[model samples]
Target: MKKTFKVVVDCDDVLFDCNGYAVTKLNREKEYAYKKEDITAWGELGCGLDERLIYFRDPVFVRDMPVLPKAREFIQALSRRAEIFIATSVAAECAGERVSSIIRNFPEINPENILIGTRKDMLKADMLLDDCPDHIRSAEVTYPVLFRQPWNLSVSGVISTTTYREFLTLVDMVQKPEPEMDPMSPVVLVGPSGAGKNRVATALEETGRYRRVMGYTTNAGSRAFYRCVSWEQFHYKRNDFVETSSYMGEMYGTCREDVESVFREGRIPLLVMDINGAVNMRLEYGARIIFVSAGKEECIRDILSRGLPLEETIRRISSIDGEMKNETLCDMTVSGTGFRVSSLEKTP
Candidate 1:
């Protein structure tokens, strides 16, 4: 009978947002419209990889890539059903960063399970899930699971999965899968200021099932924003943050340790982030997103009532429409109609 006694997973396109980020950065920095799908073969990026290689060599650059969408959820579930191992190759310069990223993002995995070298032929596992066809073919595993990518689309005659969720299906089809774990997916409450997302986060935290992750910002508004540290602190421990994004010229981010702490407590980590940050975190961490909105007029009324500088107030109000446009990407939309204007002094 087939069984997933042990499974090896690849890092790049299979887990980390490597190629896509490289493509975006390459396009924006070099002004080239190279689509990721156009990379139909290995080394198709060819000379284009020169810059990406340089960046990948930097530990910060290596660690900053968001986890692939649904990757966290998939791994979390998969690890419970089988012995999971992370096997991939990275530049020697930033290999440690890759290992740290994997362990930090996926605590279910033991550090000993991370394999640095790309010698798939050396690994012993029941199945190998990798985006590279060569690696799949080389693996010593009983089943080589080709994680479909544009570069490997032409690769045939191997077991493959087109989506992250399908990998679990493949496991079930091969073996009688174990009951799945009820993973506590992190939740992000996102909206423009005055949308009462913070209020929702607070409510969730008060329920004891959720822990609100404190964010750090280097703006005068930190005093007005609840559970936010000074941006100076963020600067001091910048590497601790998984990602950082700007909101109205002020920087904000959540540190990895805070989220890990929530996980340790067996509680969901509730977070507040801007639209872009929320979207990235959702994809990177498989976090559920809740878009909180109270309508433009109500949002403006609440912002004005904050009595912040007129310029800052206008900036937040102007960005409301853009933020609202992203509601569709969120898993749930919550009505932030009650601003609780009384608490406006400390929360936005």
Candidate 2:
């Protein structure tokens, strides 16, 4: 028989009261995202949501935050039978503070048991009881017990419960197997403006299995763009036959040999470039291409929301749009809206 000895719990509405706490204290304008109507607004914090999330992550804040009735009791009871954890989402800005907060709240619980700022789907657990449908839906857990509440009403495949006693009963009965990870194949990714080529590339890199080709180019505003060099430096550094291609008074070249070097390596190469580049590569080597795209408004929204300097954001957007208009590219087209690396790789 397999070992059955671990459970992870969500901190927000499942353990503490989120909707009530937000209603009582959360500032509408500051805490919530911008919307034309107030009551109609969902729990999205628009412009500075990433920043405001930092406040709640502090040890002073979390310890003082009210714990739900029977939450501590249920956890204590479960702790006797299995290791229990308080897992919650931590925003990028205050990831440290969030971990500190959980450690302070439950001194008895080991620091390792508390995880924050994690993709719930990536978590390895025998069972997970959360109020958020996204958390349970995304995770491949053995027993996904949905704590019955207004927030979790729409979720499917959940054992609804009003009390911790009831939740514990369901947790005791379910049996689940460890999920298997399906490795991705070696293939090329393509996308238009607002399509998530860079994002997809990053996701693949994170797996540590895919060997992606980083293209060498002249557009180096950010590291995301190709590695750039001036005309004098390019010619001096690389003593090659001079081929001139000027854009906005700046000269650039595609180093054919450097791209070929990537193919020589046994890794999957990621070439993030225009349709011409893809076509040129296809002619040289028959590589597969996957296209990525997003709606105009969604693209603008995503770009602006990243907390980058406004000028830099606008410049990148303009450049991406320019490429989209110019390129006539590839095999499969995927939506850039709400693009997640795991979702894209899993898609057929």
- Candidate that scores best on lDDT: 1
What overall lDDT, based on C-alpha atoms, would model 2 receive against the true structure? 0.55
Model 1 pairs in collision: 217-231, 218-231
> What residue runs in model 2 are displaced by over 4 Å at the alpha carbon?
1-4, 27-42, 45-63, 175-348
| Deviation from native of the Cα of residue 264 in model 2, angstroms | 81
Writing each residue's lDDT as its tens digit, candidate 2 over 134-159 gives 77667776655566564343332233
What is the C-alpha lDDT profile of model 1 across 22-77, one tens digit per residue?
87887899988877776767763565644655666678878898898888999989
* Model 2: lDDT of residue 311: 59
Give model 2 RMSD, 1 decimal.
20.9
Runs in model 1 with CA error above 4 Å?
A: 1-4, 44-50, 177-348
Error of 1 at 39 (Å): 1.3
